[model samples]
Target: MSAPLAAVPALTAPKAPKKLRSETVALDSGLTVVAVRKPGVPLVEARLRVPFLSAKAAHPARANLLAEALPTGAGGYDRAGLAAAVQALGGDISVSVDADRLAVSGNVLATNLRALLDLVAALLVEPAYARPEVATERARLVERLGMARARPGVVASEALARRMWGAHPYSLDLPDGDAVAAVTQAQLHATHRDLVRPAGATLVLVGDLPTARLVEQAGAALADWTGSPAARRVPALPASPGGPLLVLDRPGSVQTSVRYGAPAVPRSDPGFPALQLANLIFGGYFSSRWTENIREDKGYTYGPHSRVDHHTLGSTLALDVEVATEVTAPALLETHYELGRIATLPVTEAEVESVRQYAIGTLALSTATQAGLASTLSALAAFDLGLDWIAGQPKRLLATTVDEVSAAAARFFAPTAFTSVVVGDAATIAAPLAALGPVER
Candidate 1:
């Protein structure tokens, strides 16, 4: 008790630099393939990305149906046969339909890579889109819609997408129970024929496989797949018309869910890196401006952050925060203030450095795994970026000047263009929020 002890400073280790190994293969069929052969893992992941999806196709919903229907039966095998084959090989295949693309992916042991590729080839080249399976899946989608409506978060997100995109086909809602009920087997087949094609698709494989063998196997498996002339370019979305704050009333919500943002740059935009850095300083990290001001300082809620969603249709910056219902207006006001501050003020050198380090370090950590590497390539393919984008990242990130960050903030973080979405008791916070902008009650 009589002796005073000096405190020891905690040791912080420096982050290790990232090593990225990747190769891009261009197939004679015009399918671009990207692969990453990392050591220490015995598993391989293959991702096939097609740029055409529900939004661009004649019947957008069919894109999703066709993607789902493919793995159910292909290469003369029924749904059960395909399932048994994958299970026996100790592998799994899944499909996802996004606004800009459709992805079919599989993970298998290294030894079974050839078999997995054969399975994927059959799925892509020989889907039956059977009527019975289409009806069953349609019923399942109807159930999913019903379940989605019951979740406040899902409802808010769906509503936000609709409000942001307006009449754009991308805004096409996930079909509701009634809409699902209306979908027919013939419609599914017709959509499949229109959207899933060779001209607008990419194939990616990542794992510890020889490049030569992979190319040979993939070529033979996918050679028969054919389609019409690919679309020269992706459709553009109109600027999000900035307007009133939209508040969806969800009764008994203990926490007020918020989504506030507007259109931002696409992945291919020159300002992409700068905007990414600027957004990190704003709310992309745990210790960002939004978190420091809105949560740490005021104790408004648990956390807040923002992201740039790069999609085939377009891109947008999203600021998401959840707070107690009573403090919703204050939280929103603080968020807007922080956004405006980034543009108007010159960020301190320390803040700028911190964000850059955080972003670069995260990138390194993300590409450390085979699956992670494949995912990175898939995103690049979707954005039409080159294979060298990863290698070129350091120069671009380090080259970001404070002035560029400020300019990016000014260009993309305009508060006037932001659309506010709150899922809470509209009766409680509606009036207070309207004073800041028009209210879409």
Candidate 2:
């Protein structure tokens, strides 16, 4: 009395919404402002990206201290004063820096949008990196870094970054504690002076508002500020330490965290759509073949997922899984097995459609929420893109043929193309992993 799974009606992607009323305004200070009106929620989300680059002596810790200390005091207000002022306007704010740029984001009721803009713009104009406050934030950051480094998942991803990026600033996983402790308020000020500038920044506002008014508000708040020139370039990435097995020794550990990845393309690449679907079918979802084979069948990991991640500097196809220390090698073997199958086999149309629906449905859901739309648009701004491009994504996925997904899978999903590192008790699992392939001590 039930229809066969194959006989089930195929899933359809949601219709693309009409493009938002949008405009780009170039402020006098050289910051590019993108505004879009969605007009649903009585709320507004604002995202600011100020360019932050690494120096010859790269110190992520120093940059982080600068990021953390900004809100403690800015625009003639102490840290608590800033928090109180922002909260008074029904808003919250956060700041962080990566190899590419420094990000500042916050949300507020639509009625308080101007107040939020004023506070953020003021910080940009005159950040108070006071000496005592810098010391306070520095100590707390160092303590948190120690706890983060102890987790195997963190350990493995940091290892992946190191193996993926050699000598480039991207390779530094966490900031050095001693380096952090040595960071002075003068350094934070210096970093801000050299980096955070309006000319090198992009600000995005999305929610219920007029695009022109949004731009006007942004310009008024930031008009007097100045930033460095816009000619800065990200250091070109070096070649990945090619497909090799790296084993990191973590003594007396109960589980192994394995991270595998390969260089991939960015959002601008034409192949991005097919590659995204290929990733979905591989391990981007719980029902993906990689998950069905390893997590559901073999019970090697509770969470096994993959993604095609894009950063300003580059992109990668990466997946991670955790398994019992004793089964570390087995888990890696199965991961490769699934990867090989996706590369060589003729995938069923049904499999392709299933992933297609999930991908499209997720995009719709993510953009439906105000917070999600703001985050999505802000992330796109990092790549010099905007909302129209994202609105067309469901079409691109729909246009992907079975043959195309199959070809993409073969081209990008091959197991042999990956470089990986296993983090666990080297004494217990090193020999077994070594027997499987080349294992670095």
Candidate 3:
């Protein structure tokens, strides 16, 4: 005879987040600095966020080159000399850019915090953009972009963005290789002058130090780097009209990539917490219904995920999955089945409680370290959010009712609301997929 297994334990609610001491200051030069005293290791983290969005068609290539060239040489040092200076301070630095902003982020020894600030100031105010350095980065960027476009996932993402945002700047996730090759050092210098100024930007510092002293150090270092970027309006996100599935051809691909998207609420919306929880229950986690059905039960994919992607202009609910080409049609069929089920039926109390605990626990874990906290705060700075919003999220999650989660699921998870795309061997997938719905070639 075999013994019966014991019942699983019930989950307890998450505790309130710990309060940390922090300060914010706006300097006369139009920069916002936020400092937080989180004593753990003997290190500090820094993030500089500058608004980089533009309506110009040429902005993407110039912005890409400028981000790559920022740390190559600045002030009096070349690339190697700049690296040596930062390494001598027990630090590391890197630059990155996207559709919305350009960010320079790194960490350093707590005692050398002021020195790191000085280096950042130099990079912002006096970048050299040497001819040789810019030429090398431009070639490398072109090659990298060529390689990226060859992948199936990149092709599908580009198609989805085009369908979702139409002619908006958001549609162009990666710039054209020809445009990147055409960028000149002079153009990059002009881009730096126009978009990389300190005005309408923010700096975040977190580590073992008094908040007030950290703000003063930053203020003194960045005082001279001041100017407003050229004014350009970000057009509102166009409505993502749901229609026939768009089938893009990638000849001889063994796997099929499926992308589906719908409109979603931002973090500031009153219904955001419930919507977040609902997404987790649907496909945001490994234990979610969509994953359980498509991956575990049907063996269609290794995993599938859904999430709320936030942008400055709007937010979207996105779902992504890659399955074997032979199973493409069946996979999408099961996906629609699951979406329809969740949107029409009320979720159980157990499901809601499970996701709530997961959400709160993950948030607490993400902010437990200094680097993590610095990055989190910097991303939130785009929306004018700070530590107060982070500390108060657990309470909001605890108070959310099962009814709220169900309502949110019904509203956001409806299958009819999605704009879907599939990238695979059109010869094999087109007919079967067309049987499910109207598919545009």
Which candidate number has the best TM-score? Answer: 3
TM-score of each: 0.90, 0.95, 0.98
Q: Candidate 3: minimum summed lDDT over ten consecutive residues — where?
A: 9-18
Per-model C-alpha lDDT, please? 0.76, 0.84, 0.92
Q: What is the lDDT of residue 344 in candidate 1?
A: 79
Select the stronger candidate by TM-score from 1 and 3: 3
Which segments of candidate 3 are over 4 A away from where they belong? 1-8
Can you write out model 1's per-residue Cα lDDT over 172-224, one digit (the tens) per residue?
A: 64645676567677776565566677675778777787766666667777887
Instruction: Name model 1 segments beyond 4 Å from true.
Output: 1-23, 54-58, 229-235
Clashes of each: 1, 1, 0
- What does the lDDT come to for candidate 1? 0.76
2 or 3: which has the higher TM-score?
A: 3
Model 3, span 1-441: residue lDDT tens: 999999988776566666899999888888999999999899999999998999899999999989998899998999999999999999998999999999999899999999998999889999989999999999999999999999898899899999999989999999999999999999998999988988889999999999998998899888779888877877988999889999999899999999999999988788999999999999999999999999999999999999999888889999999999999999999999989988999999999888989999888999999999999999999999989889878888888999999899899999999999999999999999999989999
lDDT of 2 by residue, 1-441 (tens): 996577656555477676778899887788999888888878888889876766446458778888889888888998889999999998989988777778899999888888998899778878999888988999999998889998999999998888888777887767877788888988778777777888858898887988888888888878877857434455788766656688898899999999988888898888888888889989999899989887889888888989987777889899988899988888888887888999999678988888888988898899887778878887888787778778888888889899988888998888777878889999999888877878787
Distance from true location, Cα of 185 in model 3, Å: 0.4
- Top of the candidates by lDDT: 3
